[model samples]
Target: MKRASVAVIPAAGFGTRFLPATKAVPKELLPILHRPAIEFIFDDIVGAQIPESVLITSENKSALAMHFSEAPNLESHLQSNGSEHLLEQHQNLLSNTTIKYAIQDRQLGLGHAVLQAEQLVGDRPFAVLLPDDILLGGSSFLTKMLAVSAQLKGSVLALKRVPPDMISRYGVVSASQIAANQYRIHGIVEKPSIHDAPSDLAVIGRYILPPTIFHILRSTPSGALGEIQLTDGIAKLIESEPVFGLIVEGDHYDVGTPQGMLACALTLGLEHAEMREHLLEIFRKWSQK
Candidate 1:
């Protein structure tokens, strides 16, 4: 049986980084351009032709579901004016695909968060996306990772070469070459120092994982951080079955941080043909200050 119907998204993290702003509003609902950050992730999944998605979120993040729901009042207000077209865009966003929600309840870690959706995913392979990390490139990153999984018949992760200095901020992988732009991962280090890093390649937030990962996640003991790290489970998975890494062809932005979020918004805003001239003029004025 082919197992490719589900995509799992873990959005349960408390955005302590953004504090007061995220206190009431879920960080995932924060705007990148005009659309919320999570919406971009959903768009990418839809572009990949994934039929369904399960978002694992905590009670605090309920706004995510609300954002995706039909806003009848808002739609009516928009239509009553001459803004019916805007309503159509929003309605299409909600109606384009099916989405389910699962509660993580606790903030254990990324691995534990993903395990929350085991029931929703059942015994099939699923895609995992971290909305905080916006992958900016054509040929949707998830689609590219899924294609590699389809060919190799194993778990695959979106990997990117990070600066050596930044290695400590990401989950670094030690891999053996398998083919061009592909690797058979031997182990993964969780935020290792630059000197101690196994390799410069860091595992980005996207993953195409098999259902078997749940077992590893359950059995793997929590590390020093008192949380179950996803990289640890992936390392264990490597021991038993093949785990490959595909070098993502894109600029990755860590929108979880304020600076990163500003950069992402500015970069994407400048790329918009409609907003390009105005944005450029503002940039030029700001540079003179």
Candidate 2:
């Protein structure tokens, strides 16, 4: 098989969880350590070696489009200031990638949001990444998942072993071990109660899905929340085809909420070898007060 040719990112949600700050800014544009959250996602997508990406966004989210677009003035300004490194960084962001945009008219659920990119995706295996979930590690999460998909030739979902008590917060999957760090998914239960959860394995945001999911997403009716849940569509896909879960070798931070965002920044800051001492000193000063 010719490797998944495209990646579809769903960025249309209102991000009501962040409230006032998000009122004027799309949550995807929120910055983490001076870089927009979506920039991290784009970097990961590029690391996966996929040549094309489709960003599914809403009308109000034009800021995201502009951010990724070429900035000749900014490039020239950086160059004039002798900041050759910075200019190269800006150039790298636009190079070696073909980006396409698809508009989602309504803020439906994730499944509906992904369906909007069907035409761009065409009939082939593709990846879907949720910007809300930021994953960090020595290796790219998508890259590892793609390797698993290449070997299995089936859908692959990044899995994390969450606390049993927190299973209700995510879509939990029941799976049987297929090999080291791999599982054949038997079924997926979305946000089930702790007592009802099938397994502790929860599906994070990254996915390698076959094109059949588009039809499943379209046929899947809106749920009680009047939104098409991606979990529901995945459940339908599982009925007819085999789906696998690859336990991602990394740490995942849910950046959709305020607390989670702070945690991610702190974690990244603490891990920075150059800034660790300064960050620790600041923490110590705050503790003394």
Candidate 3:
């Protein structure tokens, strides 16, 4: 299967982890430095040659939809101030990319949120990127997944080896290494105990999935907390076809909590060439104090 030119981002989660902050603002709109986390995902999509994106969001997430929409007033203000560069930068951010929004309405599982985009995705394969999982990169990570999926003609999941103690925090996978940094996924268990974990290779937020999985998810029963688990759907897909895991090379952060959000911002700030020295000085002073 050739890699599809569309990506789906499931951003409808309640984001209960962030509490009051998320109560009024959608978690996807939170800034990771100068850009919102969703923008990072969009950057990856555009780099991967994906021209269209469907954002699956719930109510009160219109702000997220507006972020990609034209801000004529802001553009005018910047242009009138003789800030052509700023105006162009803002316009080019989403240039040549089409963003569509779908309402999940109900708070369901990640699988359910993705299912909402079936019409938008049609019958083609598509990429799924969770905004909460920010991969610090300008490009290449998603491009790699697109390559693997195109070669395998099946699903490719981004995998990372987590500590055994932390395996329970993610969906652990049992797989046989068929190639360097690549595996034939045998099974996947969600949030398993350390003792019952299949393997340390945990699934991250990046995925290139076939349209067939949507049918499986449609009939999939709700699991824990009465939410449909995308892991469960993938596990079922594994039984019928080969699913591979790619050992992604990049820094991954779960920005669902304040601590994680701060970590992402600090890491991005430190990596900025122009801001590196200033961030280092502030870090040095804070550490000494």
lDDT of each: 0.86, 0.88, 0.86
lDDT of 2 by residue, 36-131 (tens): 888778788888888899999899989888988888787788788888786465457568578899999987788999999999999989999999
Q: Pull out the clashing pairs in model 3.
A: none
- What lDDT tens digits, residue by residue, belong to model 1 across residues 80-138? 89798865655665676689999988898899999999998989888898988888878
Better of 1 and 2 by lDDT: 2
Give me the candidate number with maximum lDDT.
2
Tens-digit per-residue lDDT, 8-101, candidate 3: 9999887788878789888888878677777777778877878899999987777887778887888788788888785464456588578898
TM-score of each: 0.95, 0.96, 0.95
For model 3, the run of ten residues with the poorest summed lDDT: 84-93
- Positional deviation of residue 209's Cα in model 1 after best superposition, in angstroms: 0.4
RMSD of each: 1.6, 1.4, 1.5
What stretches of model 2 exceed 4 Å from their correct place?
none
Could you tell me the lDDT of residue 278 within candidate 1? 92
Superposed by TM-score, candidate 1 places the C-alpha of residue 126 at a distance from the truth, in angstroms, of 0.3
Residue-level error in angstroms, candidate 2, position 155: 0.6
